[model samples]
Structure formats: structure tokens, C-alpha cells
Target: MVLSSHARVITPVFSAVGGSGRSTVAGLLATGLAAMVPSVVLDLAPRLASPWPEWSSAPGAGLASIPPHMPLSRRQVHAAAGTNPAPAGAGWQVLTDHREWSAPPLAPVDAPAAWHQLAAVGGWQGVVADTAYPMAHDIVAARTAGRTGWTAAWCALPCSVPVVCTAATASGMQALQTALTAAAAEGLPVQRMVLALVSTGDGRLPAPVRAGETMLRPRVAAVVHVPYDPQIRAFGLRDATRLGARSLQASDLLVQAVLASAHASWGDPLPAAATPAALPPAHPSALPVPEKVSIP
Candidate 1:
């Protein structure tokens, strides 16, 4: 479907490499966005690496089950994500890998179409996707090779914001710096990307991190520093509602930055009440036309 003001906002959390706290940032963003708008989390990561299955009650329901229609309504999405009766919450729904890790029906192969369909889902404002591993390198490689995996660059439409995650240590900072430079060189919308600086060790900011933040600020739309949370260290993100005050506040700040960035990138437009043009008459044997656009 054509994008409009009523479409959901898509936020894909990514990282240059592993050990970057990608999943943690994704959970925080989804839960934080849920505080205001009913949101959904799409765990586009591989089945073996996904962290959401233990938390989700539903089984045999995941990426493959998602409807590929042009647009999805809120109720339709919830039904897809839930059982006969949808989960009770104004919070969020999680869609992750539910099949065997090394089985057929690979998800990442068709990631972009899933993303586009979900973004067109009505009745929500956000979708925080935990992208696959080595997001920075893999996406560039896919695009460079003429394959159409879910590259954050192409998906950074007016309603979408791609976020890159990194740790706060010296080496971590350097890795992220290198990644941004390389991705920017490849035309991956680095200027509009969101940088998430996560701190796993508690204390005053490290010198390298401070310097890195200063150096990296201009290249991205917004930079968010997520402080270390004790609960996450003790347990996991299984209970986000129990996060410390500071961590919770950081999540909210991240949501605000995403919304603000989207607004700045795409000027506010009044929500349309109906389709702007008349649709062609439908026929039983008619085939659906492929949606395509030359972004450049």
C-alpha cells in the first residue's frame, strides 16, 4: 500500500558486529514505544539467536505466517500474532522465529517484504525489529551483490528509522566509528541513522566513548546513550517493566529521538480519511501488481 500518515513507524535495531547488545536495544525501543502507542517487535534475527520464544505463549506462529496483503489492519495483525483471543495489552506483540533453526522457510531471505507489509499495518505507530546478525556488513553485501535482503538504507522511508547499536568501551567505539564510515561510503543512509551507545559497565563515561560520541554525532540523526541496568545483568530483558528508573527513562528518550528524527526527516502531514484515488475494479482471475518504486 502507498505510505501515508496513518502507517506504522518501522524501527530496525542493528549492530556492526556481535556483542553489541542489539537485542537489548530492540526490546527497550519496542517496550518504550508501547508506553504511548500499541507497538510490535519483529525479531528478524535467526531462529537460533532469537530471545523472544521463551516469552511468547503462542507457537507455530511467526514470520512465515504473516499475511502478505498490501495493508494489514490492527485487528488482523493481532489475530495473526495471537491465539483465538488476542493477548490483553495496550503494550506490544512480538513476532519471532518459531521453527527449527536449520530448517526450510528461511526468514531473512525475504525480510524486506515482511518489513514493508508490517509497516503498512494500520492502528499502530511503531515496529521495532531486531535485525539479523552482522547487520552493517551483511546489508551492504546484499545490496552490493544485487540481492534484496532487508537493508536499512532502502527501508528508511518517511515512516522508518534505522538504528545502529554499539557498546561504550574504547574498542567498541572504534568499531562503530569504522562501521559508520564504511556504511556511509556505500550509500547506506548513515546521515539519517540512529546511533545507540550502550554501557555495560557502570561509571563515568570512558574517555574513548566521550570522544567517539563527539566525533560521531554529526553523521547520524540522533545518538542515544543507554546506561547499564542491573536487572539486565542479573536476569535478562524478560521483565522490561522491572527495569531501573534510569534505564526506563533512557528507553523513553530513545523513543522520543526516533519520533523526533522521523518528524524532522518527513514533515508532518494530516492523516488521510480515505484513499486519494479510485481503485480498479476487482476480478476473480486478476493478479496483484508488484509494488515497486525507484527510491533515487
Candidate 2:
């Protein structure tokens, strides 16, 4: 389904580790979304290339160049093409910095203004920003998933979703918990978090996360299991048509989870009636904190 006329969704793929497959998850979600809604995938990571050909940067055009309040109609895009054909065929556009930059790239903190401008563009219904590791400093990626402060708290844009990717390992979960703890300390507004467990075999989630049992801060919404697929590792791209049967199935489930989180963040009624007792406490005071705790 398409987003509401005025709705602007910014789904950031977050992870504690470098190879948690956040980009792959972001690409698959973008591709699936493109099938239903006109979308754009903004690769904020300072990488040289992307696996999907759909992931491209417009020549000499970046987020900073878009003027405020300007209409971004197809005609306007064509006029700015400058010998390059308008980016068509894909349901989304991948916005990136020009290959050669005189200065350092912009950080995610410098994005709220640009995001406001980009959302005003015509026809685009949603945006998926494939971010780098939350702890990365030299990149222009969203550090805290689901936190508006990561982008300076947009004025017009209210609905933002974070899909947190973590591998099935002790360190992965610990890293995620640490990130959540930091977000809480900063008073970041994180309504919900989509925890995507990427691992081998069936990719079952840990008991603590599945039961919503945590001393963490951000609210966990869903636990998605994306089984490790060699095909995806080899290609490093997201295309359901090109993936194996198992990978395709997992990818579909991940897409559904991402959209569901987005809808919930947008204030839509949840599909399933959730009992408060079934979920972790949403209030900070309810969280368990050790008495005179010490970290060794």
C-alpha cells in the first residue's frame, strides 16, 4: 500500500556491528516498498559502491543542493538531468554525494533541513536510509536508530522507524543493549525498535529479546529471524528475484516486519491486539536497574 499524501517515512537500518547486513536489509525493504509505493533509498554510508544497480547517485546532485520549498516534479528532475537520462525504471531513487567532493561529506545531524526539502518532492511516498554502524564517526549515517535527535528532530516529519540488525551472538546482543542504553541516556524519542536477528539456520531470536525481557531502553516491537544465506553473502545485493528460495522467503518476512513497524510508528492501529502484560514495560521507572551495580 502507498503512504498517505502527506506522510514522510524515514526508515533507518541500524546495527552495532559492521557486517550485520543492515544495507542488505535496507535494500530489500526498499525494493519491496518500491513495488507498492514510489520510494527513495538514501545511502548515507561513505562507501564506494552498492550491489544493486538501483543504488545510484545523480551526477552533481546531492541532498544539500535541493532548494527549500522547490517542487520536485518529474519535469524538474528531467531539467536537472544535464545529458543524463532521468533515473527511471526503479520504483526508487538512491541519493548520494557526488563522487568528487571539495569538502568532507555531511553528517546525519545536518540532515533534518535537507530531509524537509526532500519530503516536499512530488510523487515520492517514502525514504529508506541505509545507515552505517551506530558508533561510526567519520560517516554521514544515523547513529541512533529510531531517534529523531540523530537527524536533529525534524519539525514536519514525525514518523521515523528503525530496523536494528543484529547477529545471533553474545557480542551482538550486548552491543545492541549498549546502544539502547545510550539512546535512553540522551532522552532520544524512540517509540519502537524492530529487532532483526541475522544468523544461520532458522535464525530464531534469543529468549530475552523474544519475551521483551531486557534492562534496555528502546521499546522492542518485533523480532524477525533472517536466516543467513550464502547467496546474499556472495552477491551483496538485495533482489528477491535473484535470491534463493529460502533467502527470498526470509526477505519477505523482514519486509513485512519493517512495514508493520512503520505503520505502528505512524499511529496506525496495530494488526494484533497487544496486551500490556505481554510486552516489556514502556516507562523508564519500570525498567530494572541493579542496586549499586558495577561493570568489570
Name the top TM-score candidate: 1
lDDT of 2 by residue, 25-75 (tens): 776666666665566666666634433333342343554454344334443
Q: 213, model 2: CA deviation in Å?
A: 7.9
lDDT digits (tens) for residues 24-133 of candidate 1: 88878876777666677776766677777655545436666654544344454556552111112435677665666667755354455545456445345667778776
RMSD values for the candidates in order, in angstroms, are 8.4, 16.6
Question: Where is model 1 more than 4 Å wrong at Cα?
Answer: 1-7, 57-60, 64-76, 82-89, 99-109, 143-149, 152-154, 269-296
Show model 2 residue runs off by greater than 4 Å: 1-6, 47-91, 97-109, 133-156, 200-218, 238-240, 269-296
| Highest lDDT scorer | 1
Poorest stretch of ten by lDDT in candidate 2:
78-87
Please provide TM-scores, in order, for all candidate models, with all chains considered together: 0.77, 0.63
- Clash pairs for candidate 1: none
Cα lDDT of model 1 overall?
Answer: 0.68
